[model samples]
Target: MSSEEQDPDYRFTLANERTFLAWIRTALALIAGGIAVVQFVPEFGIPGTRHGLSIVLTAGGGVLAALAVRRWQRVQAAMRRNEELPATRVPMLLGGGIFVVTLIVLVILVIWPPVGQ
Candidate 1:
């Protein structure tokens, strides 16, 4: 076999691995955040908002994680063939958007609670 074909570094497999790990970490953080919000924050009488926020956060994290895994695989395949990396800005934008929206929702929940009868 040729040197380039034998040398793994000739491709971007390492980059793909790093990207996959990053997504996993991001997913874990999101899961933790959701659990904390739902399980712990409620102890302080913030249960109502926390519960809803937890669901949203958890789902968001899951979606991000799934997307990340798929993207990683696609990128890895592209790299192996010496093709350009696929556009990833959309996922980044979506993830960011979810995070910002969640933050805003949490803030609103904290500042103006629901009408508690």
Candidate 2:
């Protein structure tokens, strides 16, 4: 890489760093949510439903956390090299994962109809 390309504009680098932090925060939130669900939330009517949900949320968070680092590195490298930034499936995957989780909760709620409902 060219000497100039080795260190691109500071603004872009800072922005990339911010994005990485945001993803990390999101992952942390997911992990915390998983813990909260398992600890505080009452069990669903179906066996293992609560634990299953917790596992999915926690695992998704772990995956996102790992992917975020990779994404940060890839973006930083591309920025330094002045190459086109790579596209990512992170948003799509996160959305889909959340959607599936929501569906699971919804199905459980409908089938079990939580207490007093």
Report clashes for each candidate as comma-separated counts: 0, 0
**Tens digits of per-residue lDDT for model 2, 1-117:** 667677879999999999999999999999999999899988788878888888888988999999999999999999898899999989998998899889889988988965554
**Candidate RMSDs in order:** 4.5, 1.8
Q: Could you tell me the C-alpha RMSD of candidate 1 in Å?
A: 4.5
Evaluated against the true structure, the overall lDDT of model 1 is 0.71
For each candidate, the alpha-carbon lDDT, in order, equals 0.71, 0.90
lDDT of 1 by residue, 1-117 (tens): 433333336446777788788888888887788898766653323456667678777887898788888998777666556567788774667668778876777677677654462
Question: Ten consecutive residues with minimal summed lDDT in candidate 1?
Answer: 2-11
Against the true structure, what is each candidate's TM-score?
Answer: 0.72, 0.92
| Model 1 Cα shift for residue 16 (angstroms) | 1.2
Task: Point out where model 2 deviates above 4 Å.
Answer: 1-4, 115-117
lDDT of 1 at 45: 30
